[model samples]
Target: MPVHDPYAWALDFEALGLVPAVGIAYSLALRRYPAERWRIACFAAGLALILAAFVTPLHTLSMHFLLSAHLLQNVVLAEWAPALCVLGLPPALAAAACRRSVVGTLTHPLVALPLWLGTYFAWHVPAAYDAALRHPTSLIHVEHGCYFVAGFLFWWPALQNAPHRLSGGTRALYLFAAFVLAAPLGLLLALIPRAVYDFYVHAPHRIWGLSPLADQQIGGAAMALEQASVLFAASTYFFLRFLGGDERAEAYRSLQRSS
Candidate 1:
């Protein structure tokens, strides 16, 4: 008789090996760049949390069948990873990197834009999603790569940390536009009546024993929530800046009136 233990199978070599390698490489790159020391620390911490999601036993257990677990994964990918990466930027490092011949060509808006959208779509497809579960190593590569590229594009305008920075108002518009476009993508996933991935649907269940459909709903919700959190945070920052500028202008007007 053969025994199947989800817990035991969760701690696979791929999960253990790939995360540390990627995390270390990211750290090394941070060291090479001229970012603030604190920002580098934040980046490292964020990557560690993100990587921990994959390498730890918790991720393994979540894969067996838990919508909450899946949500956690999406949160780490979209929100946590991007926020930390953006915090590390100050424009200079990005400008330097973009100056490289290969990077210059790659970072061109045309090239980076499509790669971001394509990578985002490709990984979510059923075939790729299923393949990721079957081969955890490949999953790490594709998933992390998608987050890295997507984060870069998503942060470029707002961070003003790119080789080119959008005007303040323009940055706000870009963020809103992204939020609107992304909302539909997430809603599409959430609204699907049937299971999109056979692996997830057929996989043995766990963590409150939620059904596959329920898990899918949670995953969609998770993505939406992640997007909302980021949009809100960025928007709030912009709003505050705008308000501060307005207050300064009003104060100047009052001084002129007194004079």
Candidate 2:
């Protein structure tokens, strides 16, 4: 019998390569546009998180051992990493990209919301999920790529300060809708009676003695919790900004009347 090694490191050269490639590209962009220090920091952090996800044992566990680990990886790839990277973009660069007709259209809130939601649920279909795991080299790559791209589009309009950026109030509402819309999948995964993805159920070795159904439930719960926390924070920030703007406008009107 072979001992299971959940903590063993797993490296994905293609994924790891993205860190330096993106860093170099960002550096070049910074030279041209001179982004603020925080923007640079956000980009660096995003790349670092991406590197962590692929280079750490998280990758190994996700690939072969645990549904929860895989779900966690998806959250990082689809939400945290993409959001930070978009936030890190230089204003000039972001504006230029947003001005492009295709980018503008796809990133429009109406279009982006559905695309992201579709990608999120479609990939989670048990058959599709199992196929990706079974063919990790090809289908898995496609799955992760789609998640990242869809996530990038999902966050672009809300976070990017381009000419077509949504107003604070509208952005808040958009995020609220996203939160509401994205919740069902996670809830389903968590509350379902059985394990939906056979990849994890039939995994050669179970980690920490968690049953497939338990692992699935944990993954689903994590997904829902993360989405709720992150989206709520973002939405509240935008909503507050909307309120502050209204207050400022009212103050200006009062000053004009007094004058």
Candidate 3:
């Protein structure tokens, strides 16, 4: 397919403002604590992935053409980006942030799970999806912002690096629940007889001449695969930790001693 807007292909600085904002915070963070280069690198890499997903031609293609691209963008923004950024934080800072009064309530699995899963389904509602597309200026910001925040909250309570520690079993359960929660949505998207969203159905510049329904299914498959890969790894890690019993705890002790 011919490129849609050759002129519009210039680097999309406006959509990429988060990089510098996070970079500034990272620089400040390094000043206050030991400059563990790995942590800084993780944050920077997360920011770069977000840029690739949203600021590069991927953004244009997703917004203008393909549902697969849009789903991939959501994974980058809502899953990988937040997780990596959290991993990059100093443990002390994360613990400090977690100590706040509101953090206890928000980080609870009951609260976080619903918010993340609810936001995920809510945004995919036809009216909501179309509205975001129609009013790209304001509503789109709301959609993106909510996803990113909810994503962070969803991961915060389950991540090994989270300031507030969860029992291994609890974390494993959370990951399993997330996988269960997402399964139906992905299945519906993938197996639906026709295109669910009218927006993509009528979208102008489809790559590879893919029919809108096929595009929708592909996106759903992508979502399902991505969810499975991440959740499975996390769940297995925690489950093994749970199984390892005292062995895992001793390993952590050994690690701390070497460090």
Score each candidate by Cα lDDT: 0.64, 0.89, 0.79
Query: Per-residue CA lDDT of candidate 2, range 70-157, in tens?
Result: 9999888899999999889999998877678898898888999899999999999999999999997899989988988999999988
Output the lDDT of residue 72, model 1: 67
Report residue 93 deviation for candidate 3 (angstroms). Answer: 0.5
Comparing candidate 1 with candidate 2, which one achieves the higher lDDT? Answer: 2
Name the TM-score of candidate 3: 0.89
lDDT, candidate 1, 1-259, per-residue tens? 2333545435546546755786677667666666678787766676676667675655765566654465567557665776676676545667777677776665544555456566666777778777776775566556755766675665655664455554555556666656666665566678888768777777754455667777777778777777777876676666676656864686689999999
What are the per-residue Cα lDDT tens digits for candidate 3 across 143-244?
A: 877888888888888863445577787889899999889777777889999897878887766678799999889989889988998987888798888887
> Lowest summed-lDDT stretch of 10 residues in model 1?
1-10
What is residue 129's positional error in candidate 1, in angstroms?
A: 1.6
Alpha-carbon runs more than 4 Å astray in model 3: 1-3, 6-11, 160-163, 246-248, 251-259
Best by TM-score: 2
RMSD of 3: 3.3
List runs of model 1 lying over 4 Å from the truth.
1-34, 89-91, 101-114, 246-259
TM-score for each predicted model, relative to the true structure: 0.75, 0.93, 0.89
Q: After superposition, how far is residue 33 of candidate 1 from its true place, in Å?
A: 5.1
- Each candidate's clash count: 0, 0, 0
